[model samples]
Target chain A: MYVSMRKLIQLATVAFATLVAGASLAADKGLTFGMLMVGPYNDHGWSQSHYEGGQYVEKKMPGSKMIYIDKVNPADRPGLTIPMVVDDLVEKGATVIVGNSDDMKDGMREAAQMHPDIKFIHISGDDVLTGKAPANLSNLMGRMVYGKMMSGYVAALSSKTGKIGYLGPLINEETRRLAVASYLGARYAWTEVLKKPLADLKFQVSWIGFWFNIPGVTADPTQVARNFFDTGYDVVLSGIDTVEATTVAEQMRKEGADVYSVPQDYIGSCETAPASCLGVPYYNWGPDYVKLFSAMQTGNWKPTWTWSGPDWTDINNPDSSAIGFVKGSALNAENAASLDQFIQGLGDGSISLFSGPLNLQDGSVYLKAGETASDKQIWYLEQLLEGMDGASK
Target chain B: MRMQGLKRHLFEIGLILGMVVLFTTLLLSLVGASPLEAFSHLFAGSLGSWAKFSRVLNVWIPLTLCSIGLLYAFRTGLWNIGVEGQVVMGAIGATAVLRLGLEASHPLFYLLAALLMGMAFAALWALFAGWLKVRGGVHEIFAGLGLNFVAMGFVLWVIFGPWKRDGIASMSGTQPFPLELWFPSLPGWRVSPFALGLTLAIILLTAWVLYRSRIGLNLDAVGRNPRAVRLFGLSPSRYMLLAIMVSGALAGLAGGLQVTGIYHRLIPSISSGYGYLGLLVVMLANFRLAPVPFIALFFAALNVGSIQLPMMMQLDSSLAGVIQGACVLSALLVFGLRTLRKRGPSDE
Candidate 1:
């Protein structure tokens, strides 16, 4: 009895010391960052890039710690709802929670309204812009529209059969805008850059109606991509949140089909299929978040609707930019040089694809001749521009 | 003697639960988490607040209804694994009625009509599976599973093709039903008093039907010996079909409540695997009615509390599933051992 009592006293002392130390450590921690991901951390696409951004914040900032909840999507983890996730994260001492993905918009907005003290950064949503979000919530997204245009330009130049197929995921303003931008780039590169007739170049976009591949609800992207190859779309561009384009292209290439693919949302995604990847138009979220984190630490953070583009000087810089297009192994040297020139022209304001005589899918005038499209028009693009052979409505 | 038997049963249940707790703690320790803190967080997150407990009740309503519905089918010796499909079909039915723009009418009429439509649609779906099992000589498991996939495809087509909002399809689901069609909530909580009352009614009804009705004896007879049921001049298939339909209707009503009470729209994952979870609940209840609601609430607590694992402890929420699976497994083990002992030493 004496030995057991002594042991219990010793254990209590150790527990008390550890509790105090933990409290002190938590108090001293500079900024606690939490991230919510819709997919696994290593998905090689959207979620992976967000995870890397979290890692970058941890590395670049001092006296800070980070935690992330991955695979938080409802389709797989049905029992976990967004409000529950948010409450738990807030209880665990997260000052700022980054709700990644447009699918998480409702949950993010609801949580932000419920918890006004904690800050929320929602990526790729118009809730902030439309004045529907709480003051504590801000929307941040990259200008991937331009990068997707660049993808179209490269895919057009490299395609042997001028037919390009876009594996689309859902029909929304964001997706419609991106698909239209790619077609714009494809038409310009085909008629002006490649000196090909407009009739010879074809771009077809198919909608799967979800961000990732859901087997039953959405069409299988891999099968759709393989069909694109089988039916003569030599260059397929991925608009979904998976590296299936590169993987599918690599498999088809092995089977002796001349096919190439453009991946979305990551610079290093070419490693998935080196021989088939043309390039990737990836979101570099680290820099903007780091700035926000710094400003927040100093108590000067203002909720801004950030629709940032790439750094003109160094597109590959991990800071101060939202969008970057990374060239891959399959891009030929000559094609790469031309694509670089095109990007430089875009940077210098010499080439303007949005400059107009543009028409809607119904042959209605969208932009008057010599009138450039405004940010609102581009951001809320309503339809697939005229001449794309696919359903926009 | 009765008291002694009850005591032995209670003691065995306690032993199984103790084994489950020990196993789960050992697993958490393997993942480098303090098991005590993990368990405390779970209890606090699930039952520590009125809001949290209400959410647990919200989950419990659907799970309990589905489990009780499944019990009817189980007692009739029918494997109605397509309860998930029935739930989806229910949502579709409710959504169709709400689309009629009849919110200006009496709210109770709208609610009753929507729920009835939901049950009717789900009954039709379940009857199709029953037909396949009886006529085609196909296994009910395969038929139910296949029909579930078909129901998913049907929902997808409706959301994308016919009922798409404003000429575009999205993952956000069909446009929300007008506010008037939404189920009235309890004064200060997210859950509806109507929904809670509905659940209680269903539970009491199911218990009465199972314990004090002639149909209960027929179902039991069908499960044990269909030939014996036939000797009584009652068609076994008719009773089996009745069991499947009643199960589907309950699941469908739960789905309807989800649309009118919770989400207010038909999302793709509206059912969210509650059908499967309900199966687990019934299994853990040892195929009895009285213990189902309690078992379901326990499941809900585990599921709702597990969100904290990922948030507070950086642990995977799948660990909740592991704990639940372990509990059921230990119960099964204890039950098997009891049966062996009852059979005497020579039987083994």
Candidate 2:
């Protein structure tokens, strides 16, 4: 037994040596980028997709290197942080720093200040100086409402009971406004197309004050999904990590319920609940990243709070959204034909998701008769719409 | 210390066991967990999955190093809690160096800088406590704990102040170091060869020092009875100071390596309570350095596995903490019970 162990050790050492040698041979043009995640890279939500986007960048830019750090707490945003892990990136020669979370304000700022030559780009951020490019730092975000509208389309199309549920994480401006766009689309489909009363189109909404599942105390989304399905809501539309929504649909199917699901993070959830899942409004953050970096390389970079969102289209368009809506297989041929026409109409400016005269669940006037909410009004949503079951408070 | 040394073998085992159980109950009461379920949760979390096992190891590597360093305190009877602060300092030191441009050299530079700076920072932190103990009337425990808070504050300040990034203005953090500077990943795991080496090296070194040196004997004497050291012509006060410093230094080394080799930067959320956890390891080991690695790893697994509870059991991670407290308390209970039995039987 001892002899076998020795032999095994020897073999392992040789293999390790060979692996190192192979890696060394393959090490060429080793450019590195930094990805800061607020949660574990494995978290199947926002963090996971961002991580995958980093992988996508690596696959596209063969010689470039990508490094990710997860679970970066807020207090670590400043300098004394033993957890910030930014200095390590600077040490590793990262030419471009990708700050993934909103809280990385301090850590990345210090890094950019200290290393002025390195290009710094912030996503889902608001601090980048507009018009005047500061040699190195820039910020990028996208029109989330555009994608939410597409999700709204799915929600509108899928509601059999004429009642749709919107599960939101952290009821902030981003979510509130997005929810409104989604509601408008659903209302448009139910009222204008199907001629159903706006009152019949119930929008059940709830806020969990978090991005992902927190062990206890908060509502377990899967349980909530099951409860929703058990209570007769058939088509579940998810505005958060679509994984939980799809998982719930899968459970319903197992229990023999005819449930259909639409999830975000378009690709994976579709695969997980293909039969029930309609494609989610998925974002492709990579193209923007590439654009930012290429502009940086050419010394012609501008820093602005840029919001890129266009009509639902193919992946390769310049102004194309980071999010894409996957067409559902369950969408009937008649509905599918209509959905396609609506999709085109959305892009060409004929069909508006928010054709007003809208009312909140409480019968409060949201948009008076002959009034459609403009872009500015949509961007700053304050309260929950009518027919929503949960407290917006 | 053989089991046979006790006049009654089963009696001693039972006593130690009884203490452990009682202590476990105490821990449960502190956190309001059903004592029985907590231990079960802990056990399940530790042995659950490959992912959980990996998390424990990740936790263990740094914690074991800290505890092994802390053995120096037990040697001289100094209850040093400053290892936590010292670690933050070392990690900060390593981060500062890496940030400044130390990463451009071979990975060895970053590794070496982290190790040396970590030890230096810990030693400095310890020396501060030693200075206080030697100068003021302050006890080593208070001084050590004070240092921990100060060091944590310092870490927070850096991440938020000078280390702040120009991003979302949210509390996220700076991006991680470049891949080249990262301690290479073990296939299918988060383990770093550098962390593994440091943990093992500290373990071996601590064991060797404690088991094979004249200094070790001096430390043992100081611990058992400080007055005895004076009788043996050794300065007890001096030894106390040295022990605290060594303990602090070890914690610093852990902190340094954790940043440079593991997390790869000085983030504000770095400590993860390894210093306090080290106390549990030392206590669980009965102050024996050699067994500390195993115990720390076990507890680390418990923590990592608890994160899984959310994924699998839909349970909270705090449940894991509840279990850990129970295990410690129960073991202590068993210890107390055995001692009670020995004394009572004689009285009866």
Second chain only: TM-score per model? 0.91, 0.83
What global local distance difference test value does model 1 have?
A: 0.84
Chain B only: TM-score of model 1: 0.91
Candidate 1: the clashing residue pairs are A170-A209
TM-score of 1: 0.87
List model 2 lDDT by residue over A150-265, tens digit each.
Answer: 66666677678876777665455566766776777777778777887878877777554445554332357787777778777776667664368778887677778788777764
TM-score of 2: 0.53
Q: Cα lDDT of all candidates, in order?
A: 0.84, 0.66
List of chain A TM-scores, every candidate: 0.92, 0.79
List clash counts for every candidate, in order. Answer: 1, 72
**Candidate 2 runs further than 4 Å off:** A1-31, A39-45, A59-62, A70-83, A103-115, A129-136, A311-321, A354-376, B1-271, B284-348
